[model samples]
Target: MDIHFYKISISGIVQGVGFRPFVYNLAYKHNCIGEVYNDADGVLIKLGCKDIEVFLDELQALAPPLAKITKITQETIEPFERSDFVIRQSHDANSSTTILSPDIAMCDACKKELFDPTSKRYKYPFINCTHCGVRYSIIKNLPYDRINTAMGVFMMCDACKKEYEDPTSRMFHAQPIGCNDCGVKTFLHVNTTTIQKDTLYHTAELLKEGKLGAIKAVGGFHLVCDATDENTVQKLRQNKHRPTKPLAILVKDFAMAKKYGVFSEKEKEVLLSKEAPIVLVKKNRSDLASAIAPGIDKVGIMVASNPLHLLLFEYIDTPLVATSANLSGEPIITTKEDIEQKLPFVDFILDYNREIINAIDDSVVQVVDEKLCILRLARGYAPLHLKLPKKIDEKVLALGANQKASVAIAFEDNLILSPYIADLDTIESIEHFQSMIANFKRFYNFDFDVVLHDSHPAYESTKIAQTFDTKKVAITHHKAHLLSVMTEPSECVSFVFDGTGLGEDGELWGGEVFVAKERKYHFKPLVLLGGEKAIKECYRVALSKLFEVYPLDEVMELELDVVKRYKSKIPLLYHLFQSKKNLKTSSVGRLFDMVASIVGVLHEQTYEGEAGLRTEALVGTLTREKRFEFTIQEGVIDIAFDFFASDFVERFYATLCSIVITLAKQEEKKVLFSGGVWQNKTLLEFVISELQKENIPYTFNTIVPINDSGISVGQIMEYING
Candidate 1:
């Protein structure tokens, strides 16, 4: 029989997902002799086979569960004499094209081995296989070899080495594979004492006893305490200085999660997915500490995604508040020393020997209108990879907005977005942003040809663009927000609503409607008294809007609590309002704040989006057919406020939906929604329902975040389209 030799190259998430072993086994089944190895580009296979088409078809169809093969190419190659198939060493190239796999949840196979008494890795906290465990978090360079990871410091044991070298073994070529004898070790630090034995048990005990502990996991550290303990939860909030901000909880499994939150089928699937993000679901029971979510009716719940968390659950059945260990508006803590120095209130610390080279927080997602909406993209959901329609010659870097910062790099046909970096208001967050940029550059061997940033002149990201020794492009904030949801270059109508962004006219714009690239409509601008301070102290925004319709005496005579609470400060604010020296904004996000304040849901926000969240929570199952009166004339939409309405918040949501539907009807174009305001689940669902009822086509971000975390992707898209 005649033999054919073919060179096959496959790209995308193929490096650390057991692609080589799957290929090697598949080759044998197909009666082919081949050698498979990873290269800078992806997995490369040299196959000597009788039927090439059959082999290639099965190669794609029977790929490993975790492998995501984006592109595959085959070509005729010279045949080499070989007795049998083999797995070859990885090849390093100056430039890398391989996508790094995100850190995955602990697989069932690993979990089984972890608990089975007969298994060698029984009770091992760091048990992992080719199917799961650390990936992007531990990796330092490309080709994804064991030597290029944080695990390279530990030498494998004899048994582990044997398993890693065996072609048929599940752990064959698993870069992070190790047995207990040669794996990373856990340490528990309490006061001046260090305890190495039974650390998980000790940590669990502390949590059960209502003591706060910082425990390191696959990505970073989490400040953990018993979720069912009200005082403990309150203590954690006090220590973190996170009053009223909902804390995410880690449960043992779906059953436990179901007890605390009502999970739909889609939410359940996302909770059990390999990415294993924190899913926001409606609260189902009151057994959890009231302080865990505060005023919100929904809870952020996640299943144990790592062996350490799973094993800790074995010691304690109570759910734990597993919030990221970090200061407000800063990056998640990675090192034990940093955790010790920063989180001094923690009673104990659980740490491991392996280094976390790339620290990321848990990704958060929600099911809106029965579709997945990413709120925060990190950990398993990043570095996000998107394919370009065509390869570009210029390598571009996009620095996202100042808040919810993320960076993206576009090289050739690949666009990689970094994990979410928190708000860049702090020095720590800015450094983290710089580190993310450096990591992406090193991963792709990238020297950017151009840098893109938001048009806001004072934005840290925009200022960072000035230091870059390349061509810099400024994309208007709302335009970038619209572009993030555009899959193709086509004329469409988009609603870009958020808290604050610099507009082309130098005013603060957060509520905007765009027909194609033209700003065709906007919400009537309102004065933001006290400027930036009004965002945190939202009562100022409410008072300013009230001032628009009512004179000073009429406003003061109103029975609104906000008016009463800030009675003394009103004179100075009214003076500022009269002078018109404050910033003017057309922000729907601020509108939510205004409504929330007027209705007494929230007056001041301790965290971003607090007022909006509280307002949504207060609406509960109430629905009102009544909408506040709104008029659109000459490309502007103006609302008449009836702040005294019994169901004002519900009516406010209804009116916003009415506005969007009216605009869609007028333009007769597909409606697209973007920006942080779209993260409001209640508002998004209401608008989606209205659009469907009217038989209007509408879409919002489902892959990337609808929030500002997606700004980097939009910036890159804007650059490409422009």
Candidate 2:
């Protein structure tokens, strides 16, 4: 038999996900003698076998569950004779092109092993295998090995070492494979006592008794309490300063999840996906605590993403509110010191030894139009990489929008986005954002040729962009939003809406409908009062909208609940509105706030999109056929129609859909929608329905997020396209 020798290289998401071990086993199975190793670029394999074609085919076809091979190149090479297949040590080079895998949910094999009574890992909280375990969060650098992670501190016991070394074992070359005897250990704290015995059981018991505490997970800490207990959930809200905003709940499984929220098949698929993101579904059980997600008709639910979470569920019957362990507008807590010092309200702490290098929050997603739409990209869905339509030769850094912030670095043809950074409002959040950028740059050895940021001069992210020692370019906020979803440049009528972004005209723009290819068009500019303060107070926005057409006396006399509720602030707001003391905004977000207030559903905005989400939620059983008339005067779209809040909300959405459809039909083009407002499921449904009715070929955000978290990608895209 004639033997052939070959060297192969594979790129993309090959490190830290058991790619080397997979290749080692596959080569051995094919009766080939070879060694596989991870390098700075990707996975490298050398094989000497008689039939190389079959080996290569099975290598790609029978790859591990977590392996994602993007590119593979092979060539004939002089291979030395080898006695056996081996997994070589990783090679550390000067440059990095390898993609990092996001954190994965615990696999079914690990789950079964964890619960098996006779198994050594019985009821082990940290049970994991090669196919499933923490990856991105624990990893500090590339060439993903145990030494580069927090798990480096724990030395594998003899039993674990044997399993890890044996080629026939499933745990072979599993970087995170460890049992309770040698892996990460969990410790529980109750009141003033810290106990290592039965930590998971104690934590579960405390949760069952309606206690609120911080529990360390794969990514970071989560403040948890019984979701079914109203008092406990209310206490959590009061302590966390998270009022009215919906909190994500962690259920036992799909069966328990069904009790709280109704899920579609697609939504179910996402819920059960390896990512295990928080899937937003329609609210069903009214018995859940109202404080969990007050005023909203939808709830975010997540099944167990880790063995620890599943272990806690064994002793508890009800769902748990597993919200991020951080103060409002701050980053999620990753360390024990941060949790103890920052969160004094937590009653107890369920801590773990394994360190989380990259502190990421849970990813939030919803199935929109049967597609999994990412809202807040993190955890299982982040450190995302995408190939641009055209190669970008310049090494560029993009500081995303201040709200829902994320950073992006473009090199070659790849755009790498960091996990979701919380809104850069407070000093802590800004520092966190800066740290993320610094870490990313250092990790990839990136030096910027140019920096891209929002056009808004006062934005924290833009301010950071200015401090960078590189050529700076500012992209209009709406333009970035519109371009973020576009793969290639095309003529399309785009509808971009959000709370506020600096327009090219130096005014705050949000409600914009324009020809994106031309980069010019009309907007519904509203009278904004009190500048930045108007964002928190929905009444001010409502008063401004009312005073736009009606006189002060007439507006005061109007039977609006918001006007009556904040009568004292009305006079001052009116004075400011007349004096033009506020920033002019063409913001659809403010319109939602105004309508939410005017309809008496909400009075203030405690969180981002609170008013808009509430308004969308209130459109409950209302028919979609009802739409109010809108006047497009000169070039601007005027929504100065008189209607109650509920009717106004529905009408506003229908009118926007109609406008986009009409504009698309007139221009003979497809419609593209982007922005934070696009996260509103109701409005998106309406627009999609309208477009489908007219058979319009409309494009929307599916790959990346529609919110400001996606702004970084758009900024980079803008630079590349230009």
| Model 1, position 494: C-alpha lDDT score | 89
Q: Which residues of candidate 1, in runs, are more than 4 Å off?
A: 489-491, 620-624
For 1-722, candidate 2 gives per-residue lDDT tens digits of: 78788999998888877778788878877778878898877899888888888888988898888877778899999869787888998988877778888999998899989999988788888887778888889888878888888888989999999999987777887888778688888888777899898888888888878889999988889999999899999998888888778999999999999999999999999999999999999998898898889988999999997999998888888899999999988999988789889988788999988888988999999988898899999988789988878776788899989899999888877788889999888999999999998877766765789999999888999899889878999988888898889555466778788889988888888888767545444656777677787888887788888887888888777787887888777887888888965677888888888888888888778998998889888674434356666766666877656745446777777766776766778777778888888899988887787779889888778868999999999898888888
* Candidate 1 lDDT, 1-722, residue by residue in tens: 68899999999989999999999889888778979999999999999999888888898898888888889998999879997899999998998888989999999999999999987788889888899999999999998999999999999999999999888899999999887789999999999999999999988888878899999987889999999999988888888889889999999999899999998899999999999999999999999999999888999999998999999988999889999999877899999999978989999999999999899999999999888889999978998898877788999999999999999888888888889899999999999999898998888786889999999999999999999999999998988888887565265788999999999898899999999878889999878898898899889999999988889989889999999999998888888999978888999999988998999878999988998899888774433357898999998899887989998988888889889988989889888999999898888897888888889988889978888888988998889878
- Candidate number with greatest lDDT: 1
In candidate 2, what residue range of length 10 has the lowest lDDT sum? 620-629
**Which segments of model 2 are wrong by more than 4 Å?**
620-625, 644-646
- lDDT of all predictions, in order shown? 0.90, 0.85
The alpha-carbon lDDT assigned to residue 29 of candidate 2 equals 79
